[model samples]
Target: MDTTALLWLIGAAGSGKTATGWAVFRELAAAGVRAAFVDGDQVGMAYPAPPGDRDNEHVKARGLGALWAGYRAAGVQCVVAAGGVGTAATVADFAAQVPGAAMTVVELTVDAAERQARLIGRGSADLVEPAAALAAAFDRAPLTEHRVDTGGRTVDEVARLVLDRVGRPAAGAGPWPPRRFPAPEPIAGERVPLLWVCGATGVGKSTVAFPVFLALLAAGERAAYIDLAQVGWARPEAPGDPGGHLLRARNFGALWRSHRAAGSRVLVVSGSGGGPADMRRYLDAVPDCDPLVVRLDARPDVLAERVLMRSKGIGVELPGDELRGLAGADLDRAVAAAQAEAVRLAADGVGAVHLDTSDRSPEQLAAGIHARLVRRGGGAAAP
Candidate 1:
């Protein structure tokens, strides 16, 4: 009898769901408890908004289901999922995706002052009021078997608090090593094609890149897509691991290899290369690969509007990068940075192909890039 379970952490934005959930799962994994961590935002990354799914919760949950199946098959005992899920229907939607696992809902709460402090710390002071509104909504209809107070507590402290109620699981073997996937045997003169979409923030890097990946699949290519930032997320970073680079690199290597082993011949990476060094790290991860870089850009106003839409959409869905921009001055700063990044990328000619996204829909942009990819010998080779 399988006794797999899930700790479903629900909270408003900035409630520490991700930080705490990461801490809890890392703690469990250290003991080789066969645990896996899933960030709702990370798994359900898509573009052009999936028609009627507002928060993208539906897709996020579905993605979780697929990942959970793989994890369970690989001998994982349980999963810790952290996201903003308020209504019973939403919870049910998530639980249905993880069949046979008992779901425990835990809400994380924070007071106004504490929330403000955290928001300000993150340069998202604009979120304080919006977060308060979200908190009020959660309060109006509380959803949780247990509530954990995150105010004035470190992420580990919150994790401990949750563990106090849920109790720790029995330990497994020593710390778990990275799971190996069955890779296809290499052939002489064979190289996988890697398409990396790079750009300024809000330039539609993810939005455009995802559709290209899908188009490749449509063309009968085994394709895999990853958001560079999403994969590298781990807490308690060492000074040398700024922005969790070291951790993300390690994780990215493992994921890329797994995708390769799974017989994917094309890789579409959606990321903004901070510089040559950052890009180099990811390039080194793939073996026998031809890399194609496409940079997406938009006018300043267009970029601002897009960033604001992602940052302030009460229930809007984005490609798993939760912190894009905030409201008010924070938004201004984000837009400025994105705009400046666009100019820099243009001057640097970082991408072999530059696509303007100001007036182009994601689908159109993807089509253009895919055509270019085919020309560059990065698309599915004739088969």
Candidate 2:
């Protein structure tokens, strides 16, 4: 009998293992393959839920064993398993337990500080100490593994690496699909193209994205604005802490589902930040879509003015002189940082179009963008 194929992802916290596993599973599913995902955390919490503050090593182990057995019995041809199975001993145990299973162990590595930052941002205070411990554990573990550094990788990019290793074809290898955006009318199609807008905070990305949304709407095209930041903020179960911000951004898959279900022809996704990592997550969230990344640029003064204006329009109560202080100092630093990030993203093969928004209204910028899209045969002529 042919052995089941098992793709095991091992990594420290914040190493993108879970996200990679999920993405791989989705890709296989999309290809009409049967696959299952098994995460240690989810397995540990599967039955007879343990106390929130209690350690259940025995239960976790049993759950893991049962999960492996179930998958094997089910003849699951592909299994994407994610967790910190760091040691050679652990791999051996898995092999013994799941006889005839072809195991490919993937190790996701991230900088210690980055892992720590991600953990803290995810509201996992428990991970702070465990992350350090896990780092040490990984060094001591002797296991041949395929390594993926996720220090700055988005989940989808990391997922692509995994998919490649598992011998899956890369996305977009076949005929191009029709593009769609969220619209009032129903779309009768199997594939839809997606355009994503991403940039750093206060870069007027939304300002640019909204007009494109309106333009598409006016043209009777199906499109929608995917305000990821707003969705992140609106999550009710999110921890009321700073870490919730990153967690929400990473875990906000619902937004993509909503857009896809609405049959949006073009999705203008407003991301929280600009980076390879962010872009990866954005793409994974909205799968099988082409991304048109628009990076808006402006002079420091112009950026500062726009930030101040937005703050005022939102009815935020700042101290009497705080706006001026921020404009003079914080805003300058922010714009510089944003520019650097944009350049970094551009270098990552994001197909970015840079627009200098200085002295240009949103309407003018939209017109320019429309012209470029038309020239590229991606959009219709402006009405």
Candidate 3:
């Protein structure tokens, strides 16, 4: 392929774009094609929207542009982006990001009943009506290069259709490798410190992790940050990898390579769920790493208040992510589930250290974590 290709998959809530995108990416990898993928919402994750870019399409565009530069340098052939951008102008904006690349927009659609059923089944009853409105908006959207009705199709079927429309490589019959799925070889770089912050929901994992990332940078170490939940945005998850734990780990491997090449000496990552086994599997995905674990915990009362506030979209730090898995009526259920998770994680001893986040500011925790890493890694702060 002389030119780069980009496939942008768009859809309303529960339309299965993420699942299909994951399938497409996996199919390409199996066919021996170097490719990259991005969950669009995850890349443009600024809390306060950039001025004039209400939906943050511009931010997403910039992010795609930057990430593509890295992928292109590393020999990626194409990129698959999936999200909800409802206008032709927005498509054009994203296209402008990768100049000279051939961009194709694939819109996934479903019948109203199917849409409502899917969203409701996903525990997002509140989004049923809004999904209809967005589906209608997509109906009127311009530059819709291709459209596929994903109503009853399996994710792989939809992915095959999408790949067909976008011109993917045909798998040749020359494979003779062993059946076992081996762990990925470590990336070709010196080992770096990987700080994984984890805990129950509303325990401020991301809040603390981001600050630690900033602290590393402030202390003169090249640092990068990733939210495991964001990378695992795919649904109907991969076989035997419930919660997309390994899938996101696989994605993180790609990101780890990119960041490591750019001289990152430390990586700060946060995730809300995943037990001990899931955590160790991620270490496999990101090889050549000196791993440090920090589990943030909060008082039951404080945790409950934080969970309720987030569900209600009050005093939330991350916009557009408040009611992700919780519908209006699921607030109490979410609170209870979070409380239970807190206890379960404590019993499992998932982290090397558990920090009580009930009263400390994120910055304070970050400072302490940074100091500990520096001492443990024998000058982790130094470049």
Best by TM-score: 3
Query: What's the residue-level lDDT of 286 in candidate 2?
Result: 48
**Clashing pairs counted in every model:** 2, 12, 0
Worst 10 residues of 1 by lDDT: 232-241
How should the candidates be ordered by lDDT, best one leading?
Answer: 3, 1, 2
**Per-residue lDDT tens digits of candidate 3, residues 1-383?**
33766788988887988778777877786676656677776665433344676776766666566556544543456677788886778878888778888778898999999889888876789989878988888787545768988988998999999888778844342332222234667677678788889999888888777776766766666666778776543321234556656556655665566555545667778886488887877888777888889899999999998887777655433422634456666877888888999999999988998899888888888778877888878125623
Model 3, global lDDT: 0.72
Q: Residue by residue across 216-282, what tens digits does model 1's lDDT show?
A: 8777776677787666433223345455444454455555554554456777888775766766766
Q: For candidate 2, what is the total of clashing residue pairs?
A: 12
| Best-to-worst TM-score order | 3, 1, 2
Residue pairs that clash (backbone atoms under 3 angstroms), model 3: none
For 244-362, candidate 2 gives per-residue lDDT tens digits of 33333333343344344434555556555445664565465545456677767666566655666644444222111123335556756755665565556556755477777787887
TM-score of every candidate: 0.57, 0.41, 0.58
Model 3, position 267: C-alpha lDDT score: 78
> Global lDDT of each model?
0.71, 0.57, 0.72
